[model samples]
Target chain A: MVQAAAVAPVPVPVSTEVYQRLQHFYARQMQSSDDLDVPAWAGSFTEDGVFATNAFPEPITGRAAIAAHCDRAFAAQAAAGIVRRHVMTMLTAEHAAGDGERIHTRSYVMVLETRRGQKPTIYCSTLCEDVLVPVDGGWQVVRREVRRDDL
Target chain B: MVQAAAVAPVPVPVSTEVYQRLQHFYARQMQSSDDLDVPAWAGSFTEDGVFATNAFPEPITGRAAIAAHCDRAFAAQAAAGIVRRHVMTMLTAEHAAGDGERIHTRSYVMVLETRRGQKPTIYCSTLCEDVLVPVDGGWQVVRREVRRDDL
Candidate 1:
């Protein structure tokens, strides 16, 4: 008879201050997306943050470039008369031992879209992997990769 | 002209110990689900924990009931020959100010299903709301509500 070994647990410690800061960062990110505030959305990232998605081959880097990307995307959604709500849930974060100032987090993202006088629908489901760093006394996303789960 | 007020930020603090415990709790939950270990899956919750879903009208309460629920669900999945990967991401936990022992968390849950040779498909997407408490020196989910996004 073969014996099964118990799995050892992995411990990840995140400070109270860091946890709150990261929560605020993600809250702002979702709020900006829902409100279509391109500037606020872009400002959630670091000055040289990178945003990449499976749909786009090239990654968008820098705060300004990210702002432009959001502007174009929001404009297209507006033209289509589609209102979007981004609901982020199931967020797990780990402190990066290699870099004390950084944290790595993964979240489940659902993009809900609604048309005028129509019911909302789940437009997309994605897994978001984020690398965050403390800057200016607050946490900012340094890199965000959106992987489409529906694909 | 009236100027719009700046949005005040919401602050939620979670301790380093609590953060790591919650991460482990979620990890175990996902691991048990993937492994079809009913006892381990149900043990992730409190003895009197409640499991509720939008799809199911009645809530499954207590450890025994929760275990039975998992057993039935996993059996059905096995019958269908579907292997599921429960990817939990975007986990944000806030220490409840009024309750020192309890924490409130929200996470994004994506269930991907694969057959023998077919590519994986997004089986379901949900926003999970959980109330967790420390029991036996480890965090256990006291209440979990699954809100389906793709419904």
Candidate 2:
């Protein structure tokens, strides 16, 4: 008979302050429409943070890569004559492990993009999955996964 | 000259421990497939917490209303033989001013409900906008505003 290993007890929960920090970080990120503060946006994460967007096939890692991703995103929207508004609502966030710094967060995102001469607003909606981490600037999104809601 | 009240200096950000505690608290609240722990959940908010759901017309205020709202939700789901598996992904949380306890948390939620019979599973996806605060139990969800992702 094989000996059974003892199961460790669950880790104590995270504090409320930490949670609030994360919330504020995201609020600013989403609320930023045009002329977003690039450095501030990137500063939300650790130096070696990761960011994933719906447009990319995989995640973009590191602060530099994350900043670059945002740059391209903003540029593309500008070229398309599209003004995009990202609204994050109905959120649920959780910890991946007892002592882990990563948090799994979920929310619905409605992207309203208005282009020149378009009568109705072109809208895209999806569910966003993100990994949040505590960093020097409070809390920032380290990884984001987006799934289309309709499909 | 009426100058905009010299923009007040930004308040110091919340600590990382507070963010972690909140993540853990949400993780625990979501672990259940049954009733929501309102008392434990309400404890996560400030004295004047705001609670909102996708189905409700107006926001519910205070701990008692929050508890009532959660209780009603759990009871309704249990009666329907519907199991709720709320998965939160792509989260961003941040701290805000006032009372030193308010935070805005946003994330994507892929909600699934399964029945005993061979019926097709029901999936309702949305974004969760939560108001969280620090309490004796670490962090609690004072308000949850669920918004549907327009298909």
Candidate 3:
């Protein structure tokens, strides 16, 4: 009979308050997209926040650029008569000891697109890595990098 | 121009200790599956824990049943010469005020399947809702329900 070695659990280094705030941020993120409020969606990040993905090798920096990017993205979807719903899940946040200023998180993002009288289809699925910081007593994303997982 | 109403963030009610434990439990859960340690994976749940999914209408209840189910599932995957990596993300834990005994969470789960000589493919993606409770000074899953997001 072979025995398996015991493995210790790794603790996610984040305070309860930070975890709750991040969850709230993600919820608002999803809601902004669902409501097609591009400005609000861009406001989720910091003034100089970065949004990067494999498709766009160059990171979209600053709130203005982010808003423009979202505006175009949302407009395209509307033109196609498609509704997009972004779902973020399996999020885990980590912070190093004595480093209370910033927190890192990883999550799975799925974009579901649907048109009238059509079944919803998954348009994109990616793994998102984020860095968040506190501003004005609330959490704001400073950087976000998305990598395709469905390749 | 129509102005969108300002949306206040909804706070997630959970203590720092409980949040940390749940994160640790999930980390261990992923590790157990990655290592193919069925017993350890099953042990993550409570004695009367229930694992239910849309695909499996019948819930697998109790630690023993969960272990058996995992054993068979792992064995089948091994026999097929396929490697399955379960990635959980966007995990959010919440508990109502005055409800300290049980905590609720929502996360996204993605399973990537790879063969010896082939590229990795996404096997499935689902949203998971979990109920956890403290037992023996650690968090243990009491109930897990999975809803498929990609069909």
Candidate 4:
């Protein structure tokens, strides 16, 4: 008969495959130049997801509010007739334990803002904090917190 | 005979367990106010870990230099009788895939400095890019990069 090991079980390390997916996630989100799909972005979260920003007093919860906020921001940018690009580096991802459905991800993001007739000016360096939860579709962000880097 | 059917293997979601451990990692390194064991802290990374600051021109590599730098900082504070404390908040962690080791992590940290006489002040809000690798003992850092929030 085969004998079972007596030592305590150690936690399994995160796989490289998961890490690659996370990198892809950031590349899709922060590196994109085109306007983000508000509803699509917001929908990439749990039903009761929360979106918090340094600019917001409180977090916007649920898909509807999150989508509305994104739409508003995009609309404001449209009115200004400015094209903005966000570049991010120094990205990282970590998985949450137990359920295996949650992840904590962070990255350094620099936003480049350029108007039709003005030179491109970079805004504040920003950090993207996300809590991702896996659902039926795929891994989606349940909570997102954006904090401006202190200059 | 059992019928043979082709089943496409679905990629399992990222593990939450790893994420929880990462939360602990952040709580320990970034948020802890108590005196940390510099040697052990340095041991958290691989032998050739990288530590960089905007205050410095080049990145410090290896555990020895990393530990030395920490020791110097601690000693400086003690010698100066500054009674200083480092407060870190707005911390976020992400998994790094650049190397194969799962010990790689990156984060954003807001450092608040409190001196004996002066009012609590902001030291620097920057991103912490760390690479952690598992060793014979436990997880250790591989490489670390810090991107300042400001220009």
CA lDDT of each candidate? 0.79, 0.64, 0.77, 0.61
Q: How many residue pairs clash in each candidate?
A: 13, 42, 9, 21
Chain A in model 3: its TM-score? 0.86
Per-residue alpha-carbon lDDT of model 3 for B1-151, expressed as tens digits? Answer: 1333234334365655665566677888987987789888998899999999987869999999999998998899999998988777656677743465678887767677899999887566666789888778877888999866433
Q: Model 4, B61-129: lDDT tens per residue?
A: 888888888888777766754432233333344444333445445556655444443333445677776
Q: Candidate 4: misplaced stretches above 4 Å? A: A1-13, A31-34, A117-119, B1-41, B44-62, B70-151
Docking class of 3: incorrect
Candidate 4 TM-score over all chains jointly: 0.53
* DockQ of all predictions against the true structure, Cα-based: 0.06, 0.08, 0.08, 0.05
- Error at A33, model 1, angstroms: 4.3
Best TM-score among the predictions, by candidate number: 1
Model 1 chain A: ten consecutive residues of lowest lDDT: A1-10
Preferred candidate (lDDT higher): 1 or 2: 1
Worst 10 residues of 2 chain B by lDDT: B1-10
| lDDT tens readout by residue for model 2, A1-151 | 1333245434334456545655656656775533455687777666777766556677778888877877887888778676555667677767765547777778888765545444224267888888777666456666777787665
Worst 10 residues of 3 chain B by lDDT: B1-10
Per-residue C-alpha lDDT of model 4 across residues A48-89, encoded as one tens digit per residue: 989887867888998888778778888888888878787654
True contacts kept of 1: 0.04
RMSD, every candidate, angstroms: 10.6, 10.4, 11.2, 13.6
User: Ranking under TM-score, best-scoring first?
Assistant: 1, 3, 4, 2
Note the residue pairs that clash in candidate 3. Answer: A89-B89, A89-B90, A90-B89, A90-B90, A90-B91, A90-B108, A91-B89, A91-B90, A91-B91
